[model samples]
Target: MKHIRNFCIIAHIDHGKSTLADRLLEYTNTITQREAQEQLLDNMDLERERGITIKSHAIQMNYKYNGEDYVLNLIDTPGHVDFSYEVSRSIAACEGALLIVDASQGIQAQTISNLYLALEHDLTIIPILNKMDLPGAMPEEVKDQIIDLIGCERDEIIPASGKTGMGVYDILAAIIERVAAPVGDPQAPLQALIFDSVFNPFRGIIAYFKVVNGEIRKNDKVKFVATAKEYFADEVGILKLQPSPRDVVKTGDVGYIISGIKEAREVKVGDTITHTARPCSEAIQGFEEVKPMVFAGIYPVDTEDFEELREAMHKLQLNDASIVFEPESSAALGFGFRCGFLGMLHMEIIQERLEREFDMTVITTVPNVSYKAYTTKGDEIIVNNPSELPDPSKLDFVEEPYIKANIITKSEYVGPVMSLCIQKRGVIVNQHYLTSDRVELVFEMPMGEIVFDFYDKLKTISKGYASFDYHQIGYKQSDLVKMDIMLNGEQVDALSSLIHRSNAYEFGKKICEKLRELIPRQQFDIAIQASIGAKIIARENVRALRKDVTAKCYGGDISRKRKLLEKQKKGKKRMRQVGNVEIPQSAFMAVLKLD
Candidate 1:
């Protein structure tokens, strides 16, 4: 057990977490030269193209240090705030973490938050200064920032360049000397925490877990404590570059288990796996369940594909456990599932994955956050969709979810950043200077405000120098109203949203204008209106396609031309009554671009 050191890499976005992992793998001789590539741990094509880690990857490595062999279990984690849940699960299975900071960029918001997560788990942190090979690298400035943040000594922080492989050996030496090995009794009942899992069409669901006690052998009959389902371990193996099957995976080791379980729900992440005959006294305490930050509806383009969509979602959920969904139906979109996501980026990635991986074409509604609606009778209802909110006559008040936002940026952009937050109905809670030029501003802002374009605008305003992170701070009462978009006289429930009263009129106006441009002009005029209950806040009209009815009467009498015009007008009116405007898919997505 002393020879096994389990640890993970945590950092802000684009701070070289995967690059550093590649160097570590190369130095430990875990992957041969032919197997190495950039962001080697990131196997997803989406991850490589976007230059970010969307999922946590686990791999085992063998190293020889001080003439003694050592086994290292490394899990690489994503840095985006939307995927913090991934980082938490990775941290739960490790004893230590490598906190990598970009020397050129100094400390950012995600770096601080990820560090706090590791500290909360009581994991030993080894700070490393990455990107030292860059020309603008400020090793001393970044070193001091790390010292002040984590309260570690100056020399303890290692300055390494991931690109050139500098200080790679030093990082390996630190992991071996500093990270403690897993501590568990081999005789104790089997208890393993399932951190992640993936589905296979040919095989079955493959679950990756870390053994907390005892051992799991091939062909052992095991049961999941959460589900109470039993299955025979058809295959057991340790994770190498590829899964290497083993007869036994003992205590303090991480490995995969395959029992030919075809169902995705049978193996849940964070569930405990134990021997069916001699199960552990209780299930192991795992990470908390993920709370999605955004709620949206996903319906199949073809209604008959609903069941296939459900199965695809189940399999996708096994891979990305952060997704939460339940069946729902809408008047305009028909049957669909109300899905919860971490943020806008996370939601977009899931939408793309659904189309690409499962070949499921889906239509997503406007994303919103869950709201608390209290009624006159003092009954509180949790509303995830605007259509679910009670009428204003019966409602007492509405509360929206708020978050404590942390933003780190250069001192000069403080003014613009503060103004942007305040414009979004945010209140500055506190402000502190992290360094002479780097400022950290804390604000309490409604979660709904940032669901749309706040992140993009912040990046643009700060010129991509600022980093932002946030966590939910519960709900607060606000003057919010439900706004619905009306095509003709009918309301499109899928486009409804709960928005603050102050910005309702302007937001409605923008949506009306955007839809006018996207909605094609038919033979009949289309009335695009945004309303709050009985009041119309904004309205626009897509003019009807005019016909040259008087072309044959070019030299006719004025009465003849007028009669022909009148006849055409009557036909258009009749057409308007029976015509059904088909709201294009682009119109649904246009709501998100009404900047």
Candidate 2:
């Protein structure tokens, strides 16, 4: 058995964890410079574009140091709190963690959140201060800050910039010296936690796991604990987190096994994968069911392409297991899926992918928070759609999901960021300086505020230095009520929402503008009114279309007119056909536009 060193890179978003992982891979010569794609661990294009790690990626590399060949298994983890459970699951598979902190931004709320999770897991933390070469760099100050946070000696800090490759070798050396090897008997029972799974049509389902105990080779029969099924490994191979796949891996190794299993849902995350002969005695904890907080309905602009939408979602789920979907039917929107996601970015990514990847126009409903409400009959109603909310008198109690947001920024921009937070009904919970010049502020804010452009406003106010993160604390009671938008005396299901008392007017006006821009000029004047129960707070109108069915086609345009009618007919299929006007799928999507 080789000496195992497994550690996860934990940090806040945009803190260079993925970059650090890339440098480490390059440091060990596991991946050539040509293969050193930026954001090496972010396998998704969306992840690379956003400069965030959305999923956990793992790779193994060998480094010869001090006359010994040390094998390192590095797990790259998502830093966002929406995926905190994923971080924990990823951390569960390792014995140590390399906590990456940006030198300029100091430690953020997400950093603290992840750091606490690692400590609770009893994982050895090798702190690495990243982005040291950036302007306004303060490695020394943040190094002390990291030491104070981890309660370790000052020398425990690894000062390095993942971008520059400086001190990367030293960071690797520290991992070997400080982090403990994987603990389990190689000769005992074979059991491991499936941290990740991927699909290859020919290979079926390939499960990647850390072999904590025992050993399994080719033809070893294994059972998925969650699915209660057994299968023999058709193939087993070690992964290097590069484009090339290696042949074999044993104890203390991160690799994958193909068991000829085809079902993707059966191979679930956090499931115990064990050898059938000698099963694991202890089941791993921390496999909490992940719940997506934000909900949106996704539909094809062309109704006949509904089948195409379903296929696109299936392909997307193969790579991203976090997205949840269920069939939804609407009188106006035809058939769609009520999709659930981690947050706003997640929702936007999905919508963008459907449009870009599937080559189909998609309409998405406004993001929403799932809440538990009660009707006057005392029946419990789980309100996922704002349209589902009862009238003010019918509602017994209403609450919203509260998020504990932590913001890290320079000292100069704290006041403006706090002002924005306060405007969004955010209550300042605590504040502390990460360093003498860098500050970390914690606040209790509604997820609704964050569902908007809070991150953008934070960075704008703080001059791009402020980093923000949020985690669901719990649901809190509030005087918030739904303000439904009605067009022509009929509620536009997509344009209804629950808003706080103070900012209801502003939110209503924003939605009104979106509707006016989206709902094309109608044949008859269409009134877009935003209201609170019986009170119309905001109103706008879609003026009648000046002309429609205009014959712009030439004499040979008979076929051209047919094509136009076919396209318009396809578009009209998604319309509600309320009376004389046709509202396109774009109108439903207007509710989702933050701009």
Candidate 3:
């Protein structure tokens, strides 16, 4: 156990964490030259194509130092803010974190936020200046930023390049020397912390955990403390590139267990696993529950697939525990689930994964943040969907969730970035310089304002130099209204959104215009109106496809043409009454891109 080191790599997006992990794997011989690849831990194809790590991956490696073999369990964590929940779970299972900072970029928003998370867990932090091979690398300047941020000594910060495998050996040595090994009694009752789990069609669920106390062996009758379910350990093993079965996984080790628990909900992440006969006294207190910042309704394209969709979500939840959902039905979209996501990116990734992994075709409604609505009857209700909001007459007020947004960018782009935040109804909280060239801007913004296009707009305005991170900061009372889109006098609940009263009109106007372009022209005119209760703010119409009955009578008398036109007009009116418009899948997505 003394030679065992468990640590995870933490950094902002594209800071070379996975690249560094690859080099570490090579030095430790975790994977051979034939199997080497970029982002080897990011198993999802979506992750590789997008050049981002969507989930935290754990793998065990063996390294020889001072002529002694050492066991190193490295968890490669996602750098995006949307996946911070994954980072927290990874942190809970490790004793140390490798804080990688891009030398040219210095310290960004996520770098600071993830550092705070690691510090809160009291994990040993090893600061590494990555991308040293780049021409713009500034080791000394970034070292100063690192020192000011973490208050570590100058020499303690290692300068390394993930591309060239520089300083890989030094990082390995630091982990053995600085990181504290797991310290728990092997003879005590088994207390293993399940940090992550996945579903396998053939073998059931595989739970990855760290043995904090005692040992778990193959064929042992184990019990999950949270669920209080007992099952025989069908397989017990350490996680390498693949699952390597073993007779036993002892204390201070990270490994996986397969217990033939077919149901995805049976094995919960953060639950403790112990022997059924000699269970631990208490369950491990893992990280706090995930707080989803965005809510959206996801319905199957075909209504009959609702059951299959639910099953897929359960299996997905086993892998990504951050997602929270409840059964919901929409008038327009039919039976579906209201899923809470960390952010837009998280929502997109989940939707894509459902399509690719589960082969579930789904229609996602407009994404909105959760709100607290206080009714005149003195009842406080949590409204995740605009359709759930109380009637305006009975509603006293609505409070929207707010976030403390931290944005780090080059000093020159501060003006544009500040203006962008202000346009999003954001209040300036503070602004400070991290270095001579880098500035950090803090703002208090309503979560609803940024749900649509704030991230994209910020990236565009800053030319992709700014890094943004935010956390929920409770709720604040705001003058808000529920804007509903009505197609021919019928409200589509899926397109309804709660918006600030000040921006509601313009936003509604934009949506109306966008739907006008996206909705195809029907035989009868389609009336697309954006309304707040009885008051319609904006309206657009998709013109009917004219048959031109007059075109057939080229030389007919004026009275004869008028008679034909009148008959056609009455026929159109009758069709409008019975013809229900079909909204294209793109129209639902179009609401999200009305910039």
TM-score of each: 0.85, 0.77, 0.86
Which stretches in model 3 have alpha-carbon errors above 4 Å? Answer: 369-384, 388-479, 521-525, 543-579
Question: Ranking under TM-score, best-scoring first?
Answer: 3, 1, 2
Model 1, C-alpha of 104: deviation from truth (Å): 1.1
Off by over 4 Å in 1: 369-383, 389-480, 520-525, 542-579
List model 2 lDDT by residue over 87-162, tens digit each: 8877888889988889998977678778878888899988887888899889888987787688888877878987
Model 3 lDDT per residue over 44-157, tens place: 899999999998999999999999999999999999888989999999999999999999999876787788899998999999999999999888889998998899999999
Clashing pairs in 2: none
The local lDDT score (0 to 100) that residue 389 gets in candidate 3 is 90
Candidates in order have lDDT scores of 0.92, 0.78, 0.92
Residue 222 alpha-carbon offset, candidate 2, angstroms = 1.2
lDDT of 1 at 517: 95
